[model samples]
Target: MSQKRNIFEEVGEQKASTPTPQGGMIDQGRGGARRGIRAWLMVLFAMVVVMVVVGGLTRLTDSGLSITEWRPVTGAIPPLSEADWQAEFDKYKQIDQWAIDNQWMELADFKEIYWWEWGHRQIGRVIGLVWALGFFGFLLARQIPTGWTGRLLFIGGLGGLQGAVGWWMVASGVTSGEGVTTVASYRLATHLGLAFLILGYIAWFIMLLSRPERDLMQARRQKEAKLWGLSTGLLHLAGVQILLGALVAGIDAGRSFTDWPLMMGQFFPPEAFSISPLWKNFFENPGLVQFIHRMVGYLLFAFAIVVFLRGRKSAHGATRAAFAAAFIALSAQVVLGIYTVVTAAPWNVAIVHQVFAILVFTLILRARFLSGYPIVTSIRGA
Candidate 1:
């Protein structure tokens, strides 16, 4: 048998024989999905974002609790005939919310809620189909590199979790003594929270994958820590603000106490502490919930301002740009929120306000990576 050469030495010889590109010894290993699950995650995740924004519209229109049933398989095809429409309405009529919560709702009126609820479910069905198709395509195309099966599994698993959660949220109002119960605010928060968590991670995966496998040794330790800190903080604060906003929604606080300089004509309403011995109002009371959301919003704005100023002198262009964007977007969000409140939470204005929260959440993450990581990467390269 011919002698087998050492594999490491063989690799060295092959490396020496292969032509190096013009830039002294071009890096051979690039283009890794080391960016993680991003390339495949984008399309599916983008649709999820659409689902969320539209879901917000659905909530504002009071469409979420309308479906009144959890028909996963058969319900996929909506009312195809007039008789079918009436049948759907009959099922809806049995709910307490129909008769008591919304008195005098017409049979024709039933069709209105039917469509919004229909659209939401239809989109979910599409998302489920797309996910299945994407999974099959990956198996056929063989684009999923080794060791990444787990990640994709997580993504798909979470997508399934979302479907179940959607039902769980809607079901909360199903048995209400009143008409189709209004969606619970906490459940609403949980659903939105999971959607953003997935969205943000996919975006980050895309951002990271688009980058080269950098020489991160210098930053290999301390730098990632700093970046992680700033990034996680930004994410945490944004999430908290969103939760407060949900609390406001749950209490239907936006519709109550509609003045800016004063809620019910006082610096702080007597109702702020009207709930209990002391602390219960911070979470349970509508007036206090929205008011605290407003105050926390101001704090978030100020936090962004301070972070951006610190980023400007840090010398990383991406970090600076991302921070700048976050600050600007935060400012716009604050303004939008103020407008939504003062204007009594118009559907258009409130939806826009929520949309801007996603945009700002994105930029905050972008800046988090920009923070000391770039400089650390440069040092490692040297």
Candidate 2:
């Protein structure tokens, strides 16, 4: 027998229960508790992507040295008055870039370059703010995934270092004499390499969080070990190619040799090691830097072919498809590289090349992720 319900109660009326994680502990279910954190990571990802593009533009337009100082707090405000603008321009005049290269530039002309560098730095500030607010908010609320706090912290640490590295790169050009108009190629490469690394790290984190933690752990059991190694190798090789490309950009090497298959009608460029000290040639010798970039591109493509062939052997269709996509992207990027060289690395074409590089980079990472946690397919198809 059951007790009678109160007559005043309407049909379906009952006490509402509070929804919460089962057992009062943070659960790692697919739809549980971590979506907000994932969204925050995605916001950071988008901001960084914009920063990369803006940074590329900064270099392409020769605007990186517009600001003679690193004013993290005060620099956010652009030149407000004509006097302020003149003050900024006067400072730029002291640098070799203005002294030797841009001496003809008037105040109006200076402002054009000034905005590019300012925009780049402002994005950096926005990213740091977003990270700080999100990280602390999550930590205080106990919303961070178990074992993930340190990973999030690492991103912040890298961002902080990136600011310093950016300054270091700019300082190279600023402190040099009239002979130098840009930062050292090696330092530029270092700066770009770090940006790519940070971008890759954020991407990997997003991929890992796409599914529940338990799913990833289970997927590891079926990891394609060989494919993983192959993809990892491809990632490393691609990274080297990117740094080499940066070197080419740093020294305007792409313009030095407009011919693709051969440099100045020869397989090897002339005066490749003309710069004395020998080691300096790698960074200062435009012909030599461009030659290395071209050779590496060829090697990178060959190795990609090998990786693709091995990838086709994978039992998982999705894994095989990922490699196929990566291969296609690599092929397109190779063509773009050749075109960029032939066109003498015009700003528009060169920027497209850089954009494609980002695509290929991401696709390679995707293939690696698939190799590690492949999506199983049915006998019929994926």
The candidate that wins on TM-score is 2
Candidate 1 deviates by what RMSD?
5.9
RMSD of each: 5.9, 4.7
TM-scores for all candidates: the values are 0.84, 0.91
List the candidate 1 regions with Cα displacement exceeding 4 Å. 1-39, 176-180, 214-228, 273-284, 372-382
Question: What is candidate 1's lDDT per residue for 314-334, written digit by digit as tens?
Answer: 555556677788888889998
What tens digits encode model 2's per-residue C-alpha lDDT throughout 1-382? Answer: 9769989999877657735445522343324346787788889988888898899899999999999899999999999999999999999998889888898999999999999999999999999999999999888977787878899999999999999999999988996465778988889999989888888998888888887776677778889999999999999999999999999999999999999698999999999889899999988899999999888999999999999999999998888999999999999999999999999999999988988888899899999999999876668774
Q: What TM-score, to 2 decimals, does candidate 1 have?
A: 0.84
- Lowest summed lDDT over 10 consecutive residues: which window, candidate 2? 24-33
RMSD of 2: 4.7
Candidate 2: what lDDT?
A: 0.90
